[model samples]
Target: MAIATFGLTNIHRRVDITEGGVLGMVLLLDHHFGIPPWALTTVLDAACYLLGWKVLGRDFLIRSGVATLCGAIFFRLWDATGPLLPNLSAQPLLAALLGGAFVGVGVGMVVRQGGSSGGDDALALVIAQKTGWRLSRAYLFTDLTVLGLSLTYIAPLRIVWSLVTVTVSSLLIDFVKTVGHSENRQKA
Candidate 1:
């Protein structure tokens, strides 16, 4: 969670390479409405978690709640420090790769533990459970939806890189889930 948020605050935000799903929505709202992402993130995450709790049950809620709380705290702590990573505005492609790897590993670990790092994960989990789609496919669906909407404000070129980032991260998340869990062996 920390690594993912660091990449988001440091690399993605600085490089103008947005992601898909909840964080992407947060960025979108921030860009268009001048709302602080930290506040919006909390509200959005809580809403999605409530939806997820109704669908996924109590244990899932408890686990995901802890992870989400930790993720939020870490995000604020990192945000307060400002972006310490080297500027990547000139190298969007590299930023995309690094950002994807960080988020993939971080969120993947949480999902592997039967939890979610953010609202997107909870929503994706619900989507997968409800639709019988693989988790990665669910992630791609949600991500692409947000990325498509991002076309309204963000450049098409940046969306191209975001697509790459989401794809890599989605694949890696599934990869991590499949590594040690036979029940989660569905391939990306």
Candidate 2:
């Protein structure tokens, strides 16, 4: 889903709007420091996974590792096949909405399974554990922070749309988590 979001954003010619996590930070670095987003995301996600191991337990780390690996592979594959994909540049809003949905569903699925795609998920979990906040709230806070910082580089209108994408993605993530937990509770 993350890869889909990236591809959609690229195809739409819109500023890449990501769910705030290490991915967002990497994008910022790419824009500001000329660092490659893939390399930075990998390193940052590895660090986040290490932190997850300490704070979220071994099982969490293992599952997150799987999610991370899958994400990396998918991203690479998407990059390789991008040229053959359909162009959606004519419909930026539609692209943003669909891209956000894909990201929300993808991340939410990983998280519902006691796994994370690393980066923001791990950080959000840690914050929720420590602060007794909802995971979605934690994610929103982090995402907003990144978007706020992004204003330095991204155009104002683009940032607004990015915020819209992030907001939609966050809401869907919360919905997925809530539905999953409710089902689990009923089973219990």
Every candidate's lDDT: 0.85, 0.71
Between which residue pairs do clashes occur in model 1? none
Predicted candidate 1 versus true structure: per-residue lDDT over 25-143, tens digit per residue: 99888989999999998898888888888998888789987887788798899889987989987888898998888888888888888888879999998898888777889999999
Error of 2 at 90 (Å): 2.9
Question: Which regions of candidate 2 are displaced past 4 Å?
Answer: 1-15, 35-39, 77-86, 180-188
Best by TM-score: 1
Question: What is the TM-score of each predicted model, taking all chains together?
Answer: 0.85, 0.80
Poorest 10 consecutive residues by lDDT, candidate 2: 179-188
Q: When superposed on Cα atoms, how far off is each prediction in RMSD?
A: 2.5, 4.0
Q: Tens digit of lDDT per residue, candidate 2, span 1-188?
A: 46433544454334344445676788888999999977998798778777777888999988887887787787777666555445555665766676667677777778877778767888887776677776677788888898888888877777776677677677666667668464323210
